[model samples]
Target chain A: MMQKSTIRVLLAGAAIATVLAGCGARDKAPAAQPQVAPSVAHSSGNAGSSAEPQAPQSKPQAPQPKTASVHTYFGDENGTGLVVKQTTITYASDSDKYGAALKALQHPGDSKAVSLFDGFTFKSVKLESGKLYLDLKLDDQARTGSEAEELTLQALQKTLFQFPEVAEIYVTVDGAKVDSLMGHMDLPYPIKRSQ
Target chain B: MKRLWVGAGLLLGMLALPQVAMAAGGATTQLFLNGKPLAAEVPPRIISGNTLVPVRIIAENLGAKVGWDDRTKQVTVTSGATKLVLTIDKPEVAVGDKTEQLEVAPTIVEGNTMLPVRFVAEKLGLKVTWDELTRSVFLYKKSSGTAAADSGANGGTSGAGGSAAAGAGAAGSTGANAGAGTAGGTAAGGASAGVAHAAEPDPDSKPGIVQAIDFTGDRLTIKTNGVTTKPNLFHLSGPERLVLDVPYAVLDEALKAKLNGTVGEIAVQHPLAQKIRFSNYSSDPPTARIIIDLKGRAELVPVEAKQLQPGQFAYDLKLAKYLVVIDAGHGGKDSGAISVTGKMEKTFNLAMATKVSELLRKEPLIEVQMTRSDDTFVELDDRVAFANTRNADLFLSIHGNKYTASSTGTETYYYRDESLDFAKTIHKHLVPATGFADRGVRQEPFRVVKGTTMPGILVEVGYLSNKNDEKKMFDEAFQNQVAASLVAGIKDYLNIQ
Candidate 1:
């Protein structure tokens, strides 16, 4: 009686082991097929247009992006200094209104400044470490002063400092430091924001 | 009584002979007196300024007859009884019963009443003689018997005798009128008559006397005895000019003393082909006739001096040469040009000009006129005008040039007109002597050039733009050279050498 019962139990154990193996194989096969097909579709599409191919290819690398930073100097209307947070400001390349006001202060009674800043527009504003950095692109109209210093100061300080994020503003004109516009004064150093 | 009558007859005969002698011998006497060679005739007689001739003689010779008048210095003459009555110094004559006024008066002298010889003689059909040299009176009466005899002798040639006699008489009258009438009339008339008439006297009068006037053409010549007197007084119109002419004149001490305050100076030159000229300058037409208070007699040869050329009637003032004015142009605010180094043109011009003036001042012959000694803008016109006002001899304007760094040289510019030669002469030496690049002389339209009456020119020194030129322009040694050259040129132009 004991020999017959032990043989039946061994058979039952063998059948259960077979069923679990089959189920595991099926799951593995479906998963492998789906992954392979999508990769193939991607490769074909890349082959059709090489220029857009890098977009998808780069997606995996998107999380590790590159950052560019530039430093500039600025002064106030009276060439004074001031401070504020970097987050509150917006910067522009050509902001003629701001430039005109600064030029007005420089010339004091010059009427030509009104027409000289007519079409100028501003481009971008940036801040790093509490200092406001203004990126400006001045049109021909905005370039005044014997050397355009007054116009640079006007646009940079007035426009950028309007934002609360801007604290101490700095400006760079065409990537250089010029002595003065039209020989009115010495613009040897960066102009400070007027308080 | 018989002896008395013989003596009276002798006396009467002497008087009658003298009259005949005067008619004949007086011809030669008048010839020498008239300042002309003997031409022909019966000389014209001037009685109380009226020319006259013997009525009976002229009329009878002219184939006319004489009639007696008992009233009013009258004598009647008739040709075929066409009678005319003439009186002394009267413009009236009676032609038969009708009275006619003559254009001029008849004249009487020394118991001889004379009438218009040509008029009365021709009217009376007589032949008259005119001695141009003697200016004496004569008549050739044509008798009927003489005419008949001449016709018989010469076969109807008697007509020739009559016409020839008339022509000869006319010729004689013309000659006579030129002499005695001319000389006697002018001498008696005096200077006042010539002035009143504004007419030229006849050319046949004595050398030292006034002559008969030619009312047709106004020309006058007066000769006076040797006596140094003031110029004869005369009046003129139209920018009224006064003229004075003297022969053998010398400025005496008294005259010189008077001239000091009254007359500016005297200039001398030959005014005419044979006349020496004297030009006098005074504030006005000499209020006091130029009283040539003389030590000796000076001859007066009054000539009507007229400019044959078109210009101011220059009175040649025979004066000693001494005075001269030198002028410099541009000053003050009119800083002509600014150098690259910021030196003002005006400053340098004035500085250099002043130096030149100082140099000239050292010379006794020169009188310098600085248009502006300081920094002040003088108008271009003012520069030359001032020189003219001062009667300057030479006007020189100093200027410096400014141009791009390329322009480098010294140039002198003059107004290309006749009046500015003195300026041009100075400029000739200016560029060469200063050791600057001689750009040569040029003609320009500048105010100083045009406005000056005197000779004027403008000098442009070395360029202020060129570094080399500027250095030379600023150098004192160069300036001295310029000044010296300018002075030398002035002296040379004036013939001071």
Candidate 2:
């Protein structure tokens, strides 16, 4: 039994040694073959260049994340409101889903006349609790209303309640609020989101 | 025979003595010339006991000397090299450079050479003074110095000499009417001839119009016709400007008075270039009123006047309002990082930034401005300079994160004390709204944030390389929530709750 166990152990050791030798050979083969096709390609493309072999392209580097907060909307017996805290949202690229959802909510008959929300696209959207948050893309064509007072409120209200996740929406155009646009309206408060 | 000769000689001597006395009386009357009497139909000439004054005497008193030629029957007066020659019994006189043909000629009265008083006085450019009490007339030469002094004293209203010319012309014609119609016709013709000569070039005209005048301070309120229009304020080097558009109307007294005290000079013009300029004289922002006369046009288009600073060779940007600077990071050559699906981190950063700007502009409490609105490379120093030039209120930079394709989160940073506090407040709500991992607020020396005087912060929304983070970033619902949270955070920090 002891002899048989020793033979089996030796066989196992031989197999391990073979695997180790294969790894070593695999590792050294690329380094030893200096006149290979890749080397020739490199030399031809970068003649007289003293650059080292390029590193692998697929390796991921650590990200420098900013410190910011998040908030969510919730409806209760007390009232419909928001709960704010520190959080972060993951990055993504598909912006059409929220646009499509917002388009579904617009009144069909009045949609043509109600140009305030036309071409409205959000860079990103998030919902905390019941409240929806949107990062809007402002442009000259985004202006609303015929008069100062009407335009300001219409712009504010139209942009706020376009999604189900949002019960209330707060807007910041370029990160600040003006006393009036064109010195005409007194926008005293943040525009609340309501259907 | 001897007795007869003696009697005749005595009679001749008596006749010669009376003639001498009459000549003396005529000369005296002309020298002491008189003006027209009050309420008199005609301007009276110098007359003594129905004996008309001699033209030679009057002319001499008015700085003109006279002489007589017996062969030609002409009398001449010479004063200061100017000679006046008149022929007796002929309606004509030659005075220095000008010649005048009189209506009534010299007549022999009591053996005296008596002529028209008005004719010679006017010809010599003398002023005749009248005494209502004595009915006496005085002739005096007009002194330019004395006339100038009188004009200055009377505030330049000494146009009496011109009126005297009219009076003389009228009297000459009236006096000739008493004689034969021939004299009347001659006087009328002479008066018309003198008028033609007097009608020369005038020396007075109006002043030029002043286009604009500016006072110190930023409050530009113009009142005109009791209605005020929105004032368009701007700054120029020569003068600063506040332009108020109104219907064409004149400035009222009160408005003029206010401008006089507030501005160095107030100019009124037709607003040809559709602009008015104001110059700052003090450190404080100037407050001024521009009265626009709207000519009853109720609808006036409002125009914003941008202030431009003078550059070395170009127009510089003038800060019309408090500036807010926004910075979008990792632009141009720096792509930052790529997501699992190959989405660039810089693109996400720019997108969020654009959204943030849109949200900020909706608020009217402050002016929303950006350092960059398009996807272009902006130098670090240039961004800082733009904010500094405008005296910005806040500088917020937007950026996105990238990690080992596994990490996912949101974070915010600030380099200064206030900015750090602001980051904490903003991150407090931003992280959870997007449902990404919270990286916690931090302090770092960011180039754009550190260089400005205003409170500034930088935001990193999520890790672009992380699959989950990328998915959330691509979600439209997430970005809107993130934008709303950021705005709320700012409002909270600004005490706008």
Local distance difference test scores for all models = 0.41, 0.42
**Fold similarity of candidate 1's chain A to the true chain A, as a TM-score:** 0.31
Taking the tens digit of each residue's C-alpha lDDT, what string does model 1 give over B81-185?
Answer: 587877766788777888777666876432235577556754554433444334443333334444335433533333334433443433333223212112222
Give the top-scoring candidate (lDDT): 2
Residue B95 miss distance in model 1 (angstroms): 65
Candidate 2 Cα deviation (angstroms), residue B45:
85
Report the error of model 1 at residue A137, Å. Answer: 34
TM-score of each: 0.30, 0.31
- Which regions of candidate 2 are displaced past 4 Å? A1-195, B1-323
Separate DockQ for every predicted complex: 0.01, 0.01
TM-score (C-alpha, index-matched) for candidate 1: 0.30
* Candidate 1: residue A187 lDDT (0-100): 39
